[model samples]
Target: MKTINFTQMKDGTKEEYDFLAEMEKPYLSLTVDRVLTELKNQGEDSLSGYKITRLEHGLQSATRAYRDGADIDWVVGTLLHDVGDGLAPQNHDRFSAEVIRPFVRQEVAWVVEHHGIFQMYFYGHHYGWDKNAREEFKDHPCYQSCADFCERWDQSSFDPEYDFETLDFFTPMVRDVFSRKAYDPKVIKENQVFGLPEPIFHKLS
Candidate 1:
């Protein structure tokens, strides 16, 4: 595909948004208005070709995870998992950890950091960089934490629409983008045990 700003891509569509406008806002009620706004305002085209705006991808992942039955905290972690992308791309694992702190549980937030390793594996495979995936993950604190995160909870326990009232967090703005996310293979596998057939929600992939 043509390389263009996520908001201004090959289709010439222009979507203006700022993902961090709500960074300073309190997340006391977990309002959909607040969360959905954050999703829309954020741009999606990757500044660094090395990856997509991780925040955008994380939001998609969380949405997919939640729609399939992931818990609230896990869903929350998915949304904020990569907020640190621009500020600390290489170190954004903690950036995500830091961003999600005020709203989610310490343990689930820890899992957000852990997601990096799994992502590196997934991304690396997607991008054809198998060798470095391990090196990149080797020393990260999130690595160990994620292993436990996966083991502590199997994918089956997650429910996609658990706190659907929070759909506002993803609706109007983020849902169009979020809904397009194809379910993660691991995520799908867990749900498949219960007969959740994977469906293509987006046309892009």
Candidate 2:
């Protein structure tokens, strides 16, 4: 069938649902391309008043992580860490973390999620905020990693003179990372993956 007949999901037959599911898988597989495009557009809206554009900063962070011998996941995480800046600036850290959570290790997600709070150490005091705000999480297992990310990648990535790699240099790596089974059963339970098209049901119900 060209399209399902039901306007509402409650009227959908099992075969119709399965057909829709099969059709969706290919679009779902394009998540990586969509994410990379979003990252590429990071500098178009606002430069955030930094010396370098968001795209440059992201590339610089990833370049440093790769040069420092980080694994593929770490490099990708650093590269797209500011991706959330495009849509959600205040909670960009969490947004970024959620975007990569399905494809990366839990540790990488943790670092991405908390890097914003950790980054406050660099200039929070300048803005009348607490520079030591990150200290509250000093005992967390990923605390040091987040702090190191802020120090070595996130915070220090604003230098315009840095010899950073281009977004093209990291495109293959992004695809590799995103190609992994999303929300792996070993890391996240199979049931928790929301394994089917809930949106169609919920929205059309």
**Top-scoring candidate (TM-score):** 2
Query: For candidate 2, lDDT tens digit of each residue in 26-68?
Result: 9989999899889878767656668888888899989888877
133 Cα displacement, candidate 2 (Å): 1.9
Error of 1 at 193 (Å): 22
Steric clash count of candidate 2: 0
> How high is the lDDT of residue 96 in model 2?
95
Candidate 1 lDDT (Cα, 0 to 1): 0.48
Expressed as tens digits, the lDDT of each residue in 34-113 for candidate 1 is 44444444555345553334335544555565665655556656665666666677887787676555455455556666
* lDDT measured at residue 51 in model 2 versus the true structure, 0 to 100: 86
Q: Give the poorly placed runs of model 1, Cα more than 4 Å off.
A: 1-41, 48-56, 123-205
Which residue window of length 10 is worst by lDDT in model 2? 196-205
